[model samples]
Target: MTAMPPSSPDEPLQPQRFFAVVPAAGVGKRMGADRPKQYLVLRGRTLIEHTLERLCGFTPIERVIVALAAEDPYREGIAILNSSRVLCCEGGAERCHTVHSALNSLAGIAADSDWVLVHDVARPCVRVEDLQRLLDRLQGHPVGGLLGVPVWDTMKRTASDDQVIGTVDRQHLWRAYTPQMFRYGVLRDALSAVLARGELVTDEAAAIEAAGLKPLLVEGAQDNIKVTRPEDLALAEFYMAQQEAGQS
Candidate 1:
């Protein structure tokens, strides 16, 4: 992949459009549901629907791409799948593969310097304000970053035997959140290289880090949570209500 040329200090940077890629291929085994967690209902809508609506609602995001399993039976039923602003592609077995597939799908349409924000479909409480904040802060940054909350709870390290190893320092530690942003070319190259080496990357930030680049950390609301367990669905509903009330 060809890298975008760096802009000189004297030259004004060109404007880059924004795009969103949501990886929704996972079965979410931890949720223990009959179907993927994203296919489950939340406030009368599927989790994937909420996620797609939230991302599509953000005005700055020109397009939203979703990567889904090849045989995902529920996708065609969602009306949003037919929307012009959203596109769907065949996803892989893993999150990294799904993301890479989405990125590849955008190759002809998105410019190398354009920004792509990778978010989780399980995170329905992500606020538009936070999304704007992240884009605002990292617009011209060399390496884009993600929205995260600072760790506030006391932490501990554990041994394989389930014994407490030691009290861990929480200083400078942040709980990573979604909408991790990076340039199209940079992210594609980073993910490609990392996956090629058979490395495991939990998020886009880790992939960027593996490419030897420091991604910026933009502070965001702690309520922007990913729904994993059944209890998390209720909490996400509460947060979503709060966000809606605030918006009203």
Candidate 2:
């Protein structure tokens, strides 16, 4: 939970640059769609397109690196992938592997102190205000954090037989969401260590935690939902419309 020291008034302060990474290698079997879920049409554009636009349009971020399946065919059709600010690389099978691959691609370009925000391609409704909030809150932090929301639903625990085992405590419980921000060196080393142990972390924050650091979870809009399954498409569409209408 350490933060960087404040610079002296007489000395010039060098701000760390922000970079974004996206892992779009998943086929999203749960979506039951013809193509990969990221390529699915949303508001007349692919989900990946919307996501990239959001990240690329953000003023703080300098470049966005997207890791796609080695044989991905849909990327070329999306014009945004050709943007000079967007870099593409071959991805691995799993989410962690894909993210690690993107990090490897960033080597020699991204400095150790640079900020890297890893976001999900399925989350097209992520708000810019949340991204700014994460940066504002985590500025100069030694170990970065992510955008999340407190879980307000009733707790439920089920057994293999579908019987309720017990009701878990909900206090201080939160749902982990994407755009998990961390220092380039810390994240890369943490992921490398986890990968060396053959451990699969579902998110960047987990890898940071495994490295013996706590990631701050900044409260974010609940509308930043991950689009999964057939029903999620409609839900995402609704959220997007709300966002555009200034209602979200």
Candidate 3:
């Protein structure tokens, strides 16, 4: 599943425009909340609202494309989506589907070589400095990459019966995080191929790997956590407060 190169060596390099895609279609049943976990309020704002505002505040990103569920009623209250920098499209049932749909929605506007950053809507604590670092580190890269942190804890492989099968190596293992950046054409094609094969990819980097390419890992702060369970809301709130206090 090797992807064809977008450009040959003879062609002059072109400036790649940065665009963001956020998959906000999931119901997040694990949280056991009345509504989608993204709609859950944190520090007086919904999770999606904070996430979108952080991305929108990043000046390098030209546009932020948000993929919402077809019948999403919560987005209407989010005023930031009305900004010229934001665009909305109907999302699919899964994260991969939503991302692929979002990419398809950008067909006319995005060039093949332009950068598309796919971020999670639950991770509202992504830092602006880390965003800039990702772009800087991946500049002129052959295949794009994502922000991640190395696994420091002891790893274990457990069986279905909750028995420890083996102690896995923690080395060379990392926790993948967003926004996973890749070329517009490469990512779109990768996700399309995976979906066509009826394969589910946990992240854009995994899809890129399936396409026979290695995505670089840029070390980022651990504070950029994705809010999944009910307790994560408090952690995210604390992280945000810490970030703000540090700046102040």
What does the lDDT read for residue 231 in candidate 3?
Answer: 96
Off by more than 4 A, model 3: 1-11
Compared with the true structure, what per-residue lDDT tens digits does model 1 show for residues 74-141? 78689997889999998998999999999999999998789999999999988898999999899678
CA lDDT for candidate 3: 0.92
The local distance difference test score of each candidate is: 0.91, 0.92, 0.92
Error of 1 at 83 (Å): 0.8
For each candidate, how many residue pairs have backbone atoms clashing (under 3 Å)? 0, 0, 0
lDDT of 2 by residue, 78-180 (tens): 9999999999998897999999999999999998778999999999999999999999999878879999999899999999999999998999999999899
Task: Quote the positional error of residue 224 for candidate 3 in Å.
Answer: 0.4
Error of 1 at 186 (Å): 0.5
lDDT of 3 at 5: 57
| Candidate 1 residue spans exceeding 4 A from truth | 1-6
Model 3, span 1-248: residue lDDT tens: 55445466798867779999999999999999998988999999999999999999999899999999988988888898798999999999789999999999899999877899999999999999899999999888777999999999999999999999999999899999998999898899999999999999989999999998989999998999999999999999999999999952
- Candidate 3 TM-score versus the reference: 0.95
